[model samples]
Target: MFNLENLFGKSTRGRRLKSADRVSGALPFITAGETDQGISAFIGNDVKVFSANTTTIDMFGSAKYRNFKYGGDDHIAVVHTNKLPKYASVFVTSAIHKSSYNGQFNYGRNFYAKDADALDISLPVKDGKPDYEIMETIISAIHKLVIKDVVLYVEKKKKELNKLTENANAVKC
Candidate 1:
């Protein structure tokens, strides 16, 4: 177990950007919402862009992994997991979610960068340190399993659709 800040480079809160002030464009504007990975809109406004491979914890303590550059509202805390490998960062994001998103932080007690810094998280350890290699391997294996399941489902759907097409043809004949 370790302080969340020690496991990463830095953690900071995002600046406030209002919906009405946003200009429409291609940059993702992340907010404190669970849907669409917390993206509220896309804008062209010049805002501080967070790096890829980072994690964002909302004021409500919902954590999300960000694989693309985005701008965030003040209600979000940016965790710089960009230094870690992609898979490892993903693992860290899950740990953050498990640690913080439990109805502990809400409207009255919102989560922030300081909250993230003080949060404790547990990771697989080896040689008295976090086993990032193991984390990467585990996440990679899970990704493979998920992909395999998706492919199998698509194949089954295709077969069923083909059977339906054949039945329709027989009815026409």
Candidate 2:
């Protein structure tokens, strides 16, 4: 584990999206939450270059990997991991989640730019640098496990539903 500042540069300098400025168009409006998907609404006109693939972390320590150029509220802090290669930020995203400071952000504690910078996070390391390849492999494996669990849950529900339907039909016959 090491200080997050060692791995990343300063937070992305950007303005917070105002509710009053919202209009129907393109671009995403991000807000604070565990996983709002960095999308609150779609608007245009106030177009700015926040860029896609940026990572947003909320006060609650929940991190989201935004896949589009998005604007966000004041409560959210954007981490500039652009120096890293494409999808490399995914590992950083996971690291952000593993940070101890994550759960500390809440009603009493607000996670701001400075807080995010100072937080301690653990990363898959090699000869001192982040192990991107291992991170991708671990993330992929966890993804498959989640998918498998979901499939099993759906299958169980279908069986239960079918049994209920069968019993109802027998009574009606």
- RMSD of each predicted structure: 0.9, 3.0
Ten contiguous residues with the weakest lDDT in model 2: 31-40
Per residue, candidate 1 scores C-alpha lDDT tens digits across 110-136 of 999999999898899999999999999
Cα lDDT tens digits, model 2, 1-173, are 76766667776534676768778877777777644564777777464556676677876767777666777777777887666654567777777877734366787887777877887777778998878778777777777899999999999999999999999999999
lDDT for residue 107 in candidate 1, whole number 0-100: 90
TM-score of 1: 0.97
Q: What is the TM-score of each candidate against the true structure?
A: 0.97, 0.78
Q: After superposition, how far is residue 34 of candidate 2 from its true place, in Å?
A: 4.1
Distance (Å) between predicted and true CA of 82, model 2? 4.9
Tell me the TM-score of model 2.
0.78
In model 1, which runs have C-alpha deviations exceeding 4 angstroms? none
CA shift of 100, model 1, Å: 0.3
What's the lDDT for residue 89 in model 1?
Answer: 93
